[model samples]
Target: MKTKAVRMYGLDDLRLETFDLPEMKEDEILVKVISDSICMSTYKAVKQGKNHKRVPQDVDTNPIIVGHEMAGVIVKVGKKYEGQFLPGQKFSLQPALNYKGSPFSPGYSYPYFGGNATYNIIPPEVMELGCLLVYDGDSYFGASLGEPMSCIIGGYHANYHTVTGKYEHIMGTKAGGDLIIMGGAGPMGLGAVDYALAIDNRPKRVVVADISDDRLKRAARFITPERAKAAGVELIYVNTAAYDDPIAHLMSLTGDKGYDDVFVYAPVKVLVEEGDKLLAKDGCMNFFAGPTDHQFNAPINLYHVHYSNTHIMGSTGGNTDDLKEALYMAANHLINPSVMLTHIGGIDATIDAIMDLPNIPGGKKLIYNHIDMPLTAIEDFGKLGENDPLFKALHERVEKHNGLWNAEAEAYLLKYFDAEA
Candidate 1:
């Protein structure tokens, strides 16, 4: 079969091309990828290429597929997985396949099985590790977003608080405790906010602090303080850059007791230190961002760490269980992963999008694998509508959902712009 995909050859070398796919073995499954969401980790892999821990050194000779957060339909199920998986079933997968303690994952490691392709082969290890997930969501984008949302869920689950005079630590964020997400107005941070509000052990107060007012305003538009209040949580958005003393201003909101949970969403050193200062006794600071620099370091208050039981930790990606939780929550309407989306594109846009992800200045960039369109922002749909009827229709649909992407928009997109059509 012939499949179109974005393949990374070496450092800063990515190509969008059509290639012949080898026949699937009995232990493999064939799939037609529908949607893929671009991730920062992909950008890092592109920059580091073979030097990246997950990317193999032979990528220059045998290029690997460039995406991971993907959703699609099973086109053919091999005999080995006949009953477990069938053709036409909607699916998503946890790309962090730690099979046999190997660092190899789908997006960065695989040559024939990555997300940025029109078709992909599901390898045996994926199914063996139970990373291949069946998604029953209405929108393919929702399934595509499941991977990122899982990371957010994993961060929440990884947070630990010490019990009074106990040697062991309690897993997960504190219940009914004050929580703060530093630099939280971005895409992943927004997901963290949504999960924090929707979780069973909800925080008493949720504070999101960012330097950019525009991003904060956009985040508030989606997950408002009113909405959080209705969920029995107090949500506040603060533009820390506007304050003369940002830490003091944020601490004042917490009644000077400090936050029980502090999530640093940006890898900035200042943000990490600020989060450390805001941590209360037994507070757990989660460094949710992945820094490009290998030697990235931030100083924390050691005094508080020893005397006040404050500590810090970080998570790279979620496990299979976390991915399942994300899918279930999205399907059950407990969390709206659409809030993370800001732009949409086709397979043709994947390369540029991944290459310039940091400068894109928005949330998730979603790519439809079987279309031919450039990366375009949701906010520009209305403007682009003046030139194209498809954009016009998309604009109307997204506007109906308060400028957010929806299943209706996705269906319309496929109907009009499907490459098969």
Candidate 2:
């Protein structure tokens, strides 16, 4: 079958192409991608005209399909895996599919199917390790979220410590502790906020620092007043840019005591230095955003590292532990991942979506691959309106799923919750 996918040709050039699905091998499964979310990695790859470790740049102009965060239903499975997965059942791609004892186990490596396309082929080794979820939950807007949440899991597992070079784990371990989400107005920053609020117990003071007040205001859409009040965490939004000395401002806000945890979700050299300044004595700084291999260059002070006793850590897409936790939380309505999704359009809208990242501020952007399909009735709540045929169809999809979507969507949203709801 021919499926439409967002293919990348070069820098800032992407197109929607209809391509045939690859033949399924004896140890593979075919899936129909329902929804795929725009992730930083995906956005960066298309924007930079090159692929990273997760996305290989096979051919600069070969028009590779770009989408990692996705959820879909299994339509076809090979003879060797008839009972493993059934047709019509929803599923999600773990993305890090690794063969246990094979050369590609864990970090070994392999080229796999990304989520932006209509149908995908997953080999047995990939399926056994990459495929996840058995039941569907919130299918309407789940695929896009799973990938981002997995990155958070990756960050957590990195065991981030303070810049002071402290070997101890200080951040995210106690309550009444402060967290600084630098450049908090963007989608990834919002994801960090959502995850922190959903899980962190420390007196729960979150400082969302960004240059745009409008984006900060928009963060409220995902965090309802009820939810914020219940958490009792003071969510403060600041329009401080990295222009002069943003760290000074953060220290002033915290009375120069520094915060317990700092999530460097967005990359800004000065902001990172400022993070280093505001890290508490036993704090931890998490470099959540995966900056380009060549983009970051700065000097570190050995004195600060030794005296402050801080810890620094970094990670990419998390392992299986993070994905599983995120999915389970999404199933129970702990964190409202859908609220973080700001834009929804078809595959053709991908370019606009990527271009809008720097300006949109908050919320994940989704590529609705199944544009021709009708909407589910109840799923229409967050939609712009019910007039469009697709919106109405989405409303119906929500109703059928009873508040939950397919397994893929549900697993995608799981990363927002800190605790299992």
Candidate 3:
């Protein structure tokens, strides 16, 4: 079958092409991508191309596809796998394949298997590793964002520590302690906030810090303070840029005891430094952002690391177990990663949208591969309504829900929008 996809060929080279996908083997499954969320890692892979660990060094032999956060439907099932998986069922992929104990993953390694394309082949290794997840959720949008959500959940699990002298570990985030989310206005930052608020062993106080007042205000609109209070969590949003002495302000909030867990969303040098400073005794700082440069350097307080028992850690993607947890949480309504969605576009504009993702000031930007449409930010629904009839309909449905993307808006787009170009 012929399908459209964005393939990373070389350094600073990404091209959309119609290519022939191989027939499904008796053990493989075919899926048609419905929804895919653009991730920062995808942009990084495009920029670095072969320099990226997973991307193929030779574009001719192995030009890989360029997206991982995706949800699709099974179109054809192999004869061998008739009982386990069937055709026409919804599914979401756990992109962190870690296949054969190699760093290679789909979207970065496999040419015929990736999220950016209209149709894809689920490789034999993916199913063998249980990287394919069944989606019974109401919206594929939620399922697409589950990949990023799983990373956040994995970070929380990795940040677990025990101050007790015994040779043991305390799993997950420290309960009843203060937690701080630096650069918390971004989409992944918002995911960490959602997970923190919804978890059973949640922190007593969650302080979300970001420089942009507008983004912070937008975040507050989604995860309202009232909702946090209802969960017995005191949520606070702070303009970290405006603060001359942020440590002083946070100290006052925590009654002199600093944060127990601090997650850094941005890979900025100053943000990491500031987040490291906010650690309490036995505090764990999770450096969630993955830097593009191999040797990205940042300063840390060594005294705090030794005397105060503070430590720093980093992680790239989630495991299969984490993806399952994310899907379960989304299905159960514990956390809606879609709350962070700010823009929607067809797969036709995916290359430009991804290249300009860092400059685009919004949360999650969703793309539907089979649709033919331009990039549309949710905030512009009302203004675009004045001229475009399609947007006029979008304005009423999206505006009523405080400018957040909803399942209804997605259904409308699928109904009215044109199919693949």
* Number of the predicted model whose lDDT against the real structure is largest: 1
Model 1, 1-421: lDDT tens per residue? Answer: 9999999999999999999999999999999999999988899899999999999989999999989999999999889999999888889999988889999998899999999999999899999988889998888999999999999999999999877867898899999999999999998989999999899999999999998989999999999999999999999999998989999999999899999999998889999999999999899999989887889998889999999989989987888899999999998889989999999999899988998888997999999999989999999999999999999999999999989999899999998865431
**lDDT per residue as tens, model 3, 256-277:** 7888999988888888888888
**How many clashes in candidate 1?**
0
lDDT agreement with native, every candidate:
0.93, 0.62, 0.86
Model 3 lDDT, full chain set? 0.86
What's the C-alpha lDDT at position 32 in model 3?
88
Greater TM-score among 1 and 2 belongs to 1
Better of 2 and 3 by TM-score: 3
By TM-score, highest first, what's the ranking? 1, 3, 2
The candidate maximizing TM-score is: 1
lDDT of 3 at 101: 80
